[model samples]
Target: MSCSDPRGISLGPRQIADGVYWVGVNDCLKDLFESLWPIPDGVSYNAYAVVGSEGAAIIDGVDEHLTYEYVEKIREVVGDLGRVKYIVINHLEPDHHASTPRLLELAENAVVLVSTVGARILESLYRVPRERIVEVKDGERVSLGDKTLRFVYTPWLHWPETMMTYLEEGGVLFSCDAFGSYGALVRGIFDDEVDLDYYLEEAKRYFSNIVFKYSKNVLEAVDKIEKLGLEIRILAPSHGPVYRKRISEIISLYRDLSLPKPCARATVVYGSMYGRTEEVVQTIERVLERSGVSVDLVDAARTHPSYTLSLVAESAAVVFVFPTYDASVFPPVREVINYLHVKQAGRGRLAAVVNTFSWGPSAKEAVDALSRAGFQILEPVVSTKSLPSPEDRRKIEELAERLSSELRKFGSCA
Candidate 1:
């Protein structure tokens, strides 16, 4: 049911339920998300239009560039844009509210609904007028004749003012960024409509890149949903698919990621010069594999931080192999560690540092950084000279064995 547009191309508003329309836009052009994470597969800004008999409410907004398409989608569904009563800002992030100002100008009758914290910052961020803003609290309900929009204040969901909107009648939870992923919707919006496995994997990467640092907050948000007894038949997030058939799987995915029951795999990240560090990396992988441990090797200089973080975040153990450059840890290797520390990864996970240096020591730098990032490092910090001498190779094997044994304790080994 796609149609051509007068101004440009539009996916149009495809209804997911009786009165709810998916009025989102795909952004496949941006190379990097948040100017940090690489999103080669692109991303989507999923907004919604919920129409009741008397009035209509628009849940979330798209990136600033797609303002026209978003507004047209709303107009397509609601006919008279003035009939829109509430422009709900589930999260104050610009991706979800960039078009709020323009939409506000179009839908003159609508007032902006945001959380108490969101209200305070909306004017500053989006130049939205305070008079047009309405502050919503946890469990607050706004009636739109036949449909009722309930707000759950789920703060610290990667943002302090984040909250979710529940359509009380439809069992649809318009979760803002909690279950978001980083893929543009090419086929359809529902979980079963598109490739579920691809989106689910993207969801994991999105969690590691965006929401992992606030894992505790994520757990609290999930618990809040359970305690409130919200019958969430559909999980409509701000990014990626609208989960219907696989709602339970998506919910459990979020819960598990927050608790971070890492999979039975290990990631080996190496930054090598002169092939010395690579030598140790390969040997370690072989040993781990022989010991019944699955291994993923990542070249720190070649792999983007987005993929690296995703791989490292879900693995049971990590082996960092790098050579000392200028008597310090290699720059590329150091960058990965910084991201791990910033994103709050490595917590309760095992890590082993393999260092090769021509001069003074550099293993201590990696050891300290990994420890700060919450990794339980294996003992003796494997250090070697310029190459793998007989003694150095023996130490490398010993380190791999220790790491594999610790991974075995986690019950991941075959």
Candidate 2:
């Protein structure tokens, strides 16, 4: 509830489990997360304080800017930083570990718990002394008297050192970015407490932008957890709201999003410098809509790549329409394409290209880019010299028919 406490004392160290307290911090000041994606609703750097009879453990840390508020949250829960015997670094990324140095300084006796790869990164990234770090292997268990923390290695879930920390007794999984989202927990911390619909969309956006590339790895990690049969009662991630009431919902969302299943929808991402490209894009959109296909038309000039990538990740097909600029692809369109490539969003997806130019149109570069990015390029790509003529309209119609036919092969829309 409202982590905007100037004094850092009003917001909760909410009890997620019997002893696991949500001590995360909300960042409203930062315009962008990782200096890339916009965070209009802000983002939370979720951390948890797992207290036991003998010792206490802090699972993950907030961003560096929120360190003061974060440490105060820990102090509120444990009274003394010395009580924190284990500082579990589920992920070493700055958003999750930037406050680590200050944390280590305050919790002088606490040993930083990390995976083997995390052990290497601890020194390299944070310069945490080897003596102060305890590298835990996969399936290794650490005890805090009544509570037991089990390490599950979920590599390439965006980072090599990424892992999940499970509190065995509490049945809580401290999944540091794996099941996390982008929205800030200003109202409440639990899924039951906030607007699930809004948060879920933000979660998908987060996954599409940050974790879509490692979708295969995501499924693998999910499989690993399923095989372990650890009854994950609560899912506490490094960002967004914690999941208790809707644990299965988030898991299912992640599974469905990460899995290579095709939805009966198509995303049309286009950038038009002039009216030429927009006119063609609108025609394609109208055709796709008329064919009983759900379509998302995104103007790359207006919409952010984060949103476009998410739509493409779920869609069965993507159509790129843009005007060639200076014998090259449109700058905005190219940026979105590069993102699609990096996020591996085009995998198992069908793509079509439409390029317009006054002099020299370049569709090959865009085709090659999409082809290498894993899209199966549809034939009869519509390229126009200036505007859509009668023949150009026919080609556009044919492209639409091909896309609609391909979409139907995936199954019914609903």
Candidate 3:
């Protein structure tokens, strides 16, 4: 059984395990996710359905805009909508649970399951009432005939009330947003069926952009699960792949990203208005490349902060180059820095600043911004006027050399 979307692609529920189907929706039409992050590769709002001999439950929901398509997918899987007994809301984020209210209208027999705190704000967020909502505490379990599900309170998984639902018999963990990625499923939905490399990389970006801010919470959640001795045979996140074969790999990656054992890579981000700062960035990029130091360059003026944050997450070092504007750090660069600071980025990283100005240098503004973002600013902040003179070029080289040497010292010996 298949369902149609605006892209003319046939997407239907794929049985990920016995009695468990991935009834998710992919939105290829949205240019931007949440109207901010760029989704050039598109993204999926994944949901799942679990059927037992006695009852059926669906985990998560898609965006409200595609209510009909999502409901149709549910129908395809369950046949009669009345058979749907439970609508499990792991997280109350709109992209995941926005379709719940509409689903509730049809599934008259269904009762909404959510976290205790989720119950408080459920009505305010989706207008789902308390009567239909059953708030679950941590370690609480509900059985649907032969299959059993447990709720674990994993708060601050980017939201205060977020939780993950664990299926007992099959050992499936429907992690709400953890281990999520940006790309939509194409050839298949499971790790074995899709391109593992692409999804894993996207998962890294997704973690950095969405979940890494609450890395401590992620670690706690993982630890909690381990202490419970729950065998998570499958990682059924609300987005991206349903990891079965590579369960340990995904879990290990999240732990590393959570602790943020940063690689010896660097991110060179800059906004050049009149090409002077561009000259410095080009010089730095060349030096980094020559040293065999893996690096990512982001043009802050053109690229969104959503991308910049992801690039910076994996980098052990960040070099910010920008021209001073209005006697302050360049607006675009400043904005990116602010976003990083707000997200508590730069936990284990080094930073360098290069400023170009027509009159007085604004190198201090850039340095102060990075400092507020928790970066350890390296020495020799380079500043140039109009264009880089011989002295400015020499200082730029020194800074690049220092950064490259630092990367090598941090285990990226290559």
Candidate 4:
């Protein structure tokens, strides 16, 4: 179906079946990141409508800014606002729920369906009335005319109230943030319609940034989805693009990421005073490369904590190099290490600590911090005062050799 480009509304509709439409709302967030990308690519907040012979149900709504436009589009299809018999809130995050208040006002008689937890959050956060809320549990079915919306409660996929709604009749799953990505849906809204490389990368970034810490819960959610055994023709997410053709491919990607296997790579993160610690980091990188091990060198001072944490989480090993000042580690490196410790991201990963100091004690304090953080130290802490003498250089080389050897062993296990 073709839609005219309106002033404040950009809608693209794909007919999933006889009466179901996959609608695309363009670039919900203009400025996604204040400190990160900090640019506008236009994000897409997608919502689907299952229009049957008798009535209609809107799966999700776009942001608040696009609520009226979404309502108008629904009217165009369903003929009147009152025909929207149900509004299923698959997620309670602001981007998806920002339009809820306005939508509730318009669909006055329509039941707002959500998980019990989701309903609580809505009432607490938005003051939504209890009478209009319809609480659902896992495996509960709500019928809207000929289509049946099946609720699957998936807790901690990202939030406690997060859930997925499956249109059993249409063979489409409205999975709200489970396999979503950042950026805006530029051209097509499905994996098969656009470049898989770009979407997959953005999806990885989104998962890493938002869902990496909840890997255990993500795995459980995937398991729950697998048991449903529905013919999943489409995976409609709240952000970025949808999965129309390659639904299993995207599910497989999430499963792999949720696994406990470490990446066959190493990340060397360091904070340098002048260039001494940086030199050691570079030397370690070269040694690891020579041993046929992939390595990523990150200046802890420059890289964001989120990206660094993701790299550290994926890598088989992590190497920390820092310069000592007043018997303490560099503030930035310390913060990064502390975050890793709190997240327990490096529990089983191989780690090597290297330090440089001019006239004070070596980075023993930093080494202790790492050890306390549960890192399996692969070698003795390597330290140097002033420049590295021949003997000190030899020690550094030995440390590199040990790190590379440990990485090889880790890779073999994987």
TM-score leader: 2
Per-residue CA lDDT of candidate 2, range 285-312, in tens? 8888887889999999999888888888
Angstrom error at residue 122, model 3: 1.5
Instruction: Point out where model 1 deviates above 4 Å.
Output: 1-10, 262-264
lDDT of each: 0.88, 0.87, 0.86, 0.76
Candidate 4: how many backbone clashes?
Answer: 3
What shift in Å separates residue 247 of candidate 3 from its native position after superposition? 1.7
Models sorted by TM-score, best on top = 2, 1, 3, 4
Give the per-residue lDDT digits (tens) of candidate 4, residues 119-187.
Answer: 877876675777888899989998876878899989887878989998888788888888887766655
Q: How well does candidate 1 match the true structure in TM-score terms?
A: 0.95
Question: 1-414 in candidate 3: lDDT tens per residue?
Answer: 011323434568888889999889887778878787777777888899998888899999998887788889889888899999999999998999889989999999999999998888788888866689998998999999899999999999999999999999999999979889888776678899777898888888788778888999999999998999999888999888889899999999999888866556999889987777777788899998898888899999898888788878878899988898989989998888888888856484799999888898898987887787789999899888867789988999999999998888767723
Model 4: weakest 10-residue lDDT segment is 1-10
TM-score of 2: 0.96
Per-residue alpha-carbon lDDT of candidate 1 for residues 1-414, written as tens digits (9 for 90 to 100): 111213323356889888999999988778788989877777889999999998999999998998999999899999999999999999988888889999999999999999999888777788777688999999999999999999999999998899999999999999989999888887777888777898899999999999988989999999999999999988999999899899889989999888866555899988987887887888999998898788999999999888998888778888899999998899899999999999965477888898998877699999999999998888768888877689888989999988887776666733
Off by over 4 Å in 4: 1-10, 33-42, 325-328, 338-347, 359-374, 412-414
Candidate 2: where is the Cα deviation over 4 Å?
1-10
Model 4 TM-score on a 0 to 1 scale: 0.87
